[model samples]
Target: MDRGRMELYNLTLPVGEKHHTLAFLGFLAGDGAPAQAIELQARYISRLITGKVAPPTQKAIKHNLETIKNFSIVRKGKFTYKVPLLKLCDLIACEIGVYPWFWRVFLRDPVLAFMVWYGPIFTAQYRLLGPDSDWDRARAACYRAYDVISANGSQRDKVKVKRDDVTVARRRQVLLFTCGISAMFALGYLGKSRNLHGAIAQWY
Candidate 1:
């Protein structure tokens, strides 16, 4: 799963790959970060599921990331233009919640997962706007946010996805399955998949 994500980003092997995911996890674990506790619990669940495929020693090595015991904050220049994009990620993260790790190992509807994860974010947002709040409007506002992120971040252009690869390749089924998982995660986050599923569905 981690290697697939690294390839998706075209990151240099070994050290570069570890740095990227670790940096994301670091930010996620920061103090007052909404995802801190969930990340910890998810990491535990992830190790349990991976136990089916990995030996105990390997699993221990993989799961043995440093526990975050101290918290700090550093104020920096803000990019106002990206604020909407940030909100879009927050919405999707809230909608997906911690279940993607489990979902990757189980059969479940991604749509249902959204509702199951919706209670908290919706309540908080609903309170901010009181009775006048509108769900559709909020959805509309974030509609292009994903597009913007995907457009800028995707490595699809770099991969040589031939016509035959889509139609006649031996790996067609795997590609399609990956694309399906990618689509599901597009409704969520590519990083959520515990397998080789990518964020961009058109990678093949």
Candidate 2:
């Protein structure tokens, strides 16, 4: 989950990609900056997002921020623009795939497993199970499942040995499912007594 969070942060327009200087600057402007500089920054960001603005010029960035601050659109207290928590969460959710690890654990549980195999199979679907759905939600869900799965000593040892492999498989399965590929086939032939092709077709 931490890895996923880092990936999301690393993909953010401002901090991750160097090409979005104007958009980054515009986003900063939206957090309550003055008029003239905000307009300039917005134009710069529009050009940037639209590919009208070329790669950032250090002089331009420095000048724009400086000019904006001088005009009282922004200030240089910590030399950082703090994004609002809700917006930050939305960005993280979109970038890293919301609730990846949590979905893994949810899919692993017998009762919740059906939710993954069949959409909304559970009764209480909308209820929040942990903290708001983000990286923290994923971690908390995983730990909760780990506690249940590892309650037995033997099971706990198995988890210790296969933890890394399991994590990788979970992430892989999620990516595949998101792309519209079902894992039912990979689970192998359930039976040929029934038309296997029909069963697989139903999943799709």
Candidate 3:
């Protein structure tokens, strides 16, 4: 395993020795109760990824979920049970290079891919672009950061900065800015979707 190649596709599995996080993404494609059904969902996703009938222990799934949360890949709401898919974070996980992993997931199951794609973008547009949202202003800041990073090196070097632990640590300011904005976007969509009507938000 190449420690320097820490992008999503190359990294070791977070649970069940497979892409359980991809499975978790599929679970979030619907309006499922994530907290309640995550264990069962983890089993189903593990089976799909590794072709293993056996499920990982609950503790392992929880640990992985916690790790992902720490990464700001998924956000839990305070009132509503819905998890904001955090599209930007998902995009950044691919590390400014190859297309997102969700796009690859699309080849195997277009419908699931569509839901995952549609849900996050829709929720983001609906909530993040609302009149009260500062997303426009936020994007400007992100672009400025993007400019600074782009100025520092070529695209290849940028990729190295993203994947190499030593480099990312050295460029901690950029990493934090990326993470901080993602959290803002995630938090912007956090709240009850009581009136949200769509396959993405109310597919129960």
Candidate 4:
């Protein structure tokens, strides 16, 4: 923990492209942690800054983050923070090309491809809808996650949109249709007929 915390202030340490990666882990592990999630980030961003995290310089900390990937997440008392697994870092970086070092590993397998395409289907679903949420909330979170993936997939925009839009659009449609069908399988898992009106409103 000391090493992880110290590397942030050690300017001698090279902060690389993966700099914003830690901020993501802190947010994920912060769930249900006693301290507000922002607090976890403040402490993290104190040494490292990335993404939408505040009070950070535009200075890159990716190398700084790399210094500590070997350290496991430490949970003390009510605090929870982590240096994301190197593999996780690779997945996050693959789209943006944060670290080219890990690309070969990512392309090595189809399953890894899935993680690249869609992360946890409902990262915030249970929290937002309770542990046993109904299909409606499940689908809501699924859609939200799918939207995130689809948006990021298009971030590169190397190909002209006129050419890529149709392709990306097809992928989006397939993903969303898959999401709804997956949701259907869980029908009545939380009581299917609870309220169609509410579900329909969210379908968009």
| Alpha-carbon lDDT, every model | 0.32, 0.38, 0.38, 0.39
lDDT for 66 (candidate 3) = 51
**21, model 2: CA deviation in Å?**
8.1
- Note the clash tally of each candidate: 0, 3, 0, 8
TM-score of each: 0.21, 0.21, 0.20, 0.25
Candidate 3, superposed: residue stretches over 4 Å from native: 1-46, 49-54, 64-79, 87-204
After superposing candidate 4 on the true structure, give the runs of residues whose Cα lies further than 4 Å from its correct spot. 1-117, 120-122, 125-131, 152-159, 163-169, 172-204
Q: Candidate order by TM-score, highest to lowest? A: 4, 1, 2, 3
What lDDT is reached at residue 55 by model 2?
51
Task: Give the 10-residue window scoring lowest on summed lDDT in candidate 1.
Answer: 65-74
Query: 7-85 in candidate 1: lDDT tens per residue?
Result: 1110111233432232222223122334423333334334434552232243333322211111111221321111122
RMSD of each: 18.4, 17.8, 20.1, 16.2
Report the lDDT tens digits of candidate 4 across residue range 42-73: 43344334343233243434533443333334
- What is residue 115's positional error in candidate 4, in angstroms? 7.0
**Model 2: per-residue lDDT, tens digit, 53-172?**
355456644544343333332333433443332233323332223322334544444323433234311112211232223434444454454445446435444535556546756865
lDDT computed for candidate 4: 0.39
Best by lDDT: 4
lDDT of 1 at 136: 47
Residue 101 lDDT in candidate 2: 31
Comparing 3 and 4 on TM-score, the stronger one: 4
- Candidate 3, residue 25: how far the Cα is off, in Å: 11
